[model samples]
Target: MTTSEHGAVPGLFTLVLHTHLPWLAHHGRWPVGEEWLYQSWSASYLPLVRVLRALAAENRTHLLTLGITPVVAAQLDDPYCLQGMHHWLANWQLRALEAATTRTASGPSPASAPEALRRFGSREHAEAERELVEFDAYWRHGASPVLRELIDGEVIELLGGPLAHPFQPLLHPRLREFALREGLADAGARFAHTPRGIWAPECAYAPGMETDYAAAGVGHFMVDGPSLHGDTALGRPVADSDVIAFGRDLQVSYRVWSPKSGYPGHPAYRDFHTYDHATGLKPARVTGRQVPSADKAPYDPDRADAAIDGHVADFVDTVRKRMRAESERIGRPAHVVAAFDTELFGHWWYEGPEWLARVLRALPAAGVRVGTLSDAVRGGYLGGRVDLPPSSWGSGKDWQVWAGERVADLVQLNNEVVDTALTTVDKALARAAAVGAPTPRNPVADQILRETLLTVSSDWPFMISKDSAADYARYRAHLHAHATREIAAAAAAGRQEQARRLAEGWNRADGLFGALDARRLPVA
Candidate 1:
């Protein structure tokens, strides 16, 4: 680890925010669809980008490692998504306005109106207005230009993952390699830099996956601490490869968000689940975890600000103490990494972005060194070789969540879909070669692979296991699975016209990554 320049703490801290969501374009828009995308975009992505740009103005570099999965990048840059996002932002402003005026102008008597509701309306309206302007100014084009600014400026290290965020451990080996390469290429095309590290979907991994990383020029990847057997003081070289595996430091990470407690549970923070039905705005504070929504108190920005300050200090102290102790016990400086879903900041925990900003500034002030994961590797934070077992950051820190008994059916469906897709594509290629008309981009085969990848995404199994919108998850998985089967079957027969028609129709609904080519699939 790098020594503190001011003789403060002698350890390193890396914060990784994995940004991803399943492709929701042209899908349903309520409970769990494009709504999910718009909420995260307005709440998390917009604010997070603003925070980074603010810090960048102060000349901060290596602030954090941000993993924007290839599938998400595709949607962010897609014309359809951009148009939809604009509509969402405008609608948000309208809702906020309605909340501010609906009760005062036409509801129950103004004297009987709850002051808390009025306060919420005013605050939300102001925020919505500001966000609308922000969206129009920077995000109207898409997330690419703004994200590219950060990537090119070196404000953060971008981590790229496979197309569609498939859980690699359960994937066929050839498909896994194909997805990784295509995902990296997608990132390269969007940001003009191919990421050297990836936040493996769910931090999922299997032994010997390092050879694939090495082949794709990926220098490092993240895994859960249990996968390292909890000795996570430093990055480790996996097996016999030069690729490094950094494990999340759960001891420190869980301090902010955990199974039992975290700062977001504080009473002053905005309650994520409680909503104002009329305006669809969350108007309550988390007065108590088990408290009923009716009894919850109105959110107070001042109180939440105090909570953020306290939590930031507590987190910095935790990191400092943990690092000092671990460094002593390990006979050297320790490197601590804290990874979380990017959506957690503003979407799940309303005050999370502020807490994050304060923590980033406070850690250095408290003498703890902060940098990206690349800095940790370059500063000699690597330990001896480790042979990892199959692991994920999911429940049990094992593969059970994605391949558990609960999702056995999905596992089987994924297998069948992938096999049919690969076989169909192989035969199509062979036939084309025999006809002396090799094609660079077979629309039918490409759509088959696209649907196949979407069908195998880890999100489906995760949602099914967690039961958080399991029905929607099931619908999406099977929807893509059916598409893959029909498209592949049509192509496998001599029904060229029918295959093209099916592919074209599917393209209108499920299409993302217009650059995806069937030829990119490995032939061996």
Candidate 2:
């Protein structure tokens, strides 16, 4: 085992943040589409990166492992998205100004015009100005440059994943392999740094995926704690494969946020659902669980700031205790990995970014070793080997959220589209080979594969099962599936001109990955 300067303190701590969203650009915008991207970019990505840059300036390296899925990275680098995000930020500032004017002209009492609205307006206006400066200075070129700076400086380890976030366990073998390789290639092209590890979509895995990962040059991946039978203090090699699987420590992770209870539920934090009808801003605090949103108290930044300190301390203590206890039990320096969606910071929980910053800074002072997942493996924190079953970080710790009875129809639709697309592409390739011609680099077939991959995204089924934006999720799935069918039909009928027109239309609408090639599919 490798030794640190502290000479075997309590244990190691690794934070993994998975960043992802479906191909939302050029789709819809309001209610659920590109708006999701802009909001997250403004609230989460910008502020979080600023925090990291601050920490890096202080010479703190290897702060966390960041997974930016290929599809989301595509959107971040898209010309259309950058322009739309700038416009969105400018509009946010205008809206804040309008809210301030409205409040000043007609001064209402505390009951009518809560203090939270005014405070929120001022805060948003200031933030918009600050973010606009950052965007013009750093992000106007796209997120790749910003991300590359961090990776190059050793401030963060980048984890990548498949082209679209497909549920790998259910995907056909050939398509799954193609997606994984292409996704890594896309990331390499964007960052100029091929990731040695990846955040498997949904942390979903089936037996024998290790061989594929190994072939793709992935050294490690993340899985849920239960997948390792609840002993998650150390990484474990998957059934004799050198590829390591790190289990997320739910104990330390759940301290920040969980389904039932967490720090975000504190009374002082901003309420996520309740919004001011006029200003479209969250103006109420989560005063009480049963309290109606209207009756909730106005959000006080001071109170929330105090809550953030408390939560940070609580999280640090929890990590320390878990690591110490696990180290003693295992008779070695153990590691605890706490993973979460990167958007949770500043997007869902307003105080999350502050909490994260404080926690990272405090952990090292509290004698906790802060490192990335790669550090854990290199430092010999991997445990014994075992065969991992099909698992996901979902409800019931299985594939219920994506492939359960509730989403059976979507599951069937996804399978049919995938099968049809694959067969059509394979037949086209064979026709070219049989005629003693060069293999066809068919753009139509490539677009069909792209549509098929988008249709199988885990988001649709998860949203439908959870009853959150079920209609939008269904619309996206069916829309992509229909596109795949149309393109495949045109190709099958030998209508080259029609196929080219249809493909170009779809390409303009749903295009993200320009490097995607249909020739990657295995021979039929």
Candidate 3:
């Protein structure tokens, strides 16, 4: 017989979500900026927050560990972002209104009446208005409150990363410290909770980052196990530091979804691409006999409930088997953490909320205890020493996904931009202090500092790696490059006027990293 019932396991399963988006507000829209924020807010943030709130209301303790990178948090809390998101929701209402007017007057799906449908106050407009009204209320009223409540209640563990979410592994060592230290401080101030852990952007890792983590007062960090230098199975404390490193559990992590294959790709699921251009709602089928996106299909909760039940059963069973085997070898409770991007739920995996809710409810009923990484570590689980290989949860768990030759141009741009940033920081630090003002925690200079951190965000490289919106990545690179180059030039020449102008320009455009101060950088 199995050592557990209902497929419950003897290990800790930490469900982690890394939520990050670059500072896009005040930049542009449609192809970037406000649009990006609204899209993710609608697709991922609102729904994920709702899931957490529901779980919290049920008194689910330590439900999930979430890493909300500093940049995304900045966007969320920014006044401009606050207004823009609200306005975006409002505009969505207006569009729905417009669509309804057109349909009512022109007749639905009629080539002859297409012109009439485009005008105001048409005949078939009420349904579109309703959809918009619901969307606005769900996001503004439902999701926003849940997000704040989850944070304040301490129901979900929050994690942060370097400002603008840079790839620390290859970032300039100096700038890495600049980004992460400032980011943690910002999160603490904004959320009223200090993060002891961080989700390194892109699961990127390099040796010697632990020292920076320690210096920044960070006690723990998460990376793909392979990136730990071989500590794949559990969170391992780095040598000579209280900071702990946890790796992603591939066995269980892969079961739900992977970069290559997962339940999302199942023929029955809705297609992520290919929306009806006219209606902008998905209205097609993935497989031959699959459910069509359009038609009166109103998201049958029963069908979804059954699918979740089956998946949860299989998941619990797998955990039980793993637990028994680990107990035999380790003679104690082994820990497991399955890490994933938060966007996978409502955004990418439409039915992910159902699956998560069911799995969480069933795990405990099955005898497996659900917990976070901190609890497992504090509970006194000992991990054997092992050298983790270099791995990421990216495509192929390798650098080929991001740094491959196809992205040589982007890589070169990063190298140049970072070097410029380092130089800018040094020069700015030397020029002046705020006349006995307290030295900032980050050593990077003002304009030079903010621009540099934003420039190095892992998002640009990640987007380029996936070839998703290469245009946006290119635009972001040049934007930062200009700032980095300009700020350093002004600091070097002691041209306060020019420096202030460039800084102000950046300020108008910069959405995060407001805490960056050049006096923190040590002279080199």
lDDT of each: 0.89, 0.89, 0.66
225-335 per-residue lDDT for model 1 (tens digits): 999999999999999999999999999999989999988999999989877776778877898888887677778899999999989878887888889988998999999
RMSD of 1: 2.6
| Model 2 stretches with alpha carbons more than 4 Å out | 1-8, 104-116, 434-437
Ranking by TM-score: 1, 2, 3
What is candidate 2's lDDT per residue for 92-173, written digit by digit as tens?
8887766555544222223126344666678778888999999999999899999999999999999999988999999998
> Candidate 2 at 127: error in angstroms?
0.9
Better of 1 and 3 by TM-score: 1
Residues 1-524, candidate 3: write the lDDT tens digits.
23254454666767888887777876778756678778677657766665676788888778888898877777776767766777765565555455544443222222213342343223224433443454566544333244556767767787878887776766767777777878888778776777888887777666667778999988777777556543345567766566788888677787888657666665545456534344443322233234433331222334555666677788877766666665666677777778888778766766677677777777788777777767777776546543434545577666665678777776777788778767766555444454476644432257677777777677777787888887888788778878878867875677767777777777777735666665555455
- After TM-score superposition, the amount by which residue 514's alpha carbon in candidate 1 deviates from its true location, in angstroms, is 1.3
Q: What TM-score would each prediction reach against the true structure?
A: 0.96, 0.96, 0.84
Q: Candidate 1: minimum summed lDDT over ten consecutive residues — where?
A: 104-113
